[model samples]
Target: MKDGKAGAVTELKPSRPLDHADALRAHGSSLLLIEGNGKLDKVTVKGDQAEIDTIKDGLAEPVSVTAVGGTGWIAEGKLSYIIGDNKGKDPGPFTLTPVALPK
Candidate 1:
């Protein structure tokens, strides 16, 4: 991790098979969000083991994700948002929040 100090890169293995993860974002510490298989999953790492939890599900092929101030907006078949209580911690039950995608 290149937070500040230069050190050897440590590989974090996901608890479950990724299958086809297309997008990823890092949250505080070892928490991450992966977009794949029409869903968004939040992953956390402890030591060398990682765990995945579903944050959002049932979308049309989500491919990318971007976050700001601990809030993430996903681009599935459409660019919309799923609001959750995650702010660098706590994998949440995220819900969809509608937004107008640019035409």
Candidate 2:
């Protein structure tokens, strides 16, 4: 985006189609998504292609997600919750890390 204005919408082809994306949020140049199968995925788009990778799983149908600093907080359909970090060299995996919220 030049000058903070959105450019043309580009349709990217996912490595594997996200058939059950419940929640999606943009993180930098990538897109973070929660699928209906209780999987948290990080999607990176480049040109007309997008790659998908599982971050954290075994959730209870996550419905929402938000990223604070380098941590991501997910709402798992009111049953349980999970958290993770930006997984160093590899993007996914999202190992759990301690987080401090604002008052």
Candidate 3:
């Protein structure tokens, strides 16, 4: 939750704060995914913000993507092998057949 410039952290008031014209940026070690605005970006925030008080059931497995938000992913074999994106639900459960290795 610290904002810095050049090499020092500076405090700026809403009136004198730096321009947010670039973008609303935040960084943290962990993140959580939530639902909002009929989208999936509203429920995300930096870990330092809070204990990630999610109202929804939330994703099965949550992973932090650069301290931005929670992301979904499919993993297998104790996380040794994984495939596909799990951020969102799978409307249709597809199958992944293994290919025969070289004889």
User: Deviation in angstroms for 59 in model 1?
Assistant: 1.6
TM-score of each: 0.57, 0.65, 0.19
The model with the greater lDDT, 1 or 3, is 1
Question: Residue 101: error of model 3 in Å?
Answer: 45
**After superposition, which runs of candidate 3 have C-alpha atoms over 4 Å from their true positions?**
1-51, 64-80, 83-103
Q: Rank the candidates by lDDT, best first.
A: 2, 1, 3
Write candidate 1's Cα lDDT for 6-37 as tens digits: 98766877777775677667766544454556
**lDDT at 53 for candidate 2?**
84
Task: Output the lDDT of residue 89, model 3.
Answer: 47
What does candidate 2 score in Cα RMSD to the true structure? 11.6
Clash count list over all predictions: 0, 0, 3
| TM accuracy, model 3 | 0.19
lDDT of each: 0.59, 0.69, 0.26
Candidate 2 residues lying further than 4 Å off, grouped into runs, are 1-6, 78-103
Which pairs of residues have clashing backbones in candidate 1? none
- Best of the two (1, 2) by lDDT: 2
Candidate 2 CA-lDDT value: 0.69
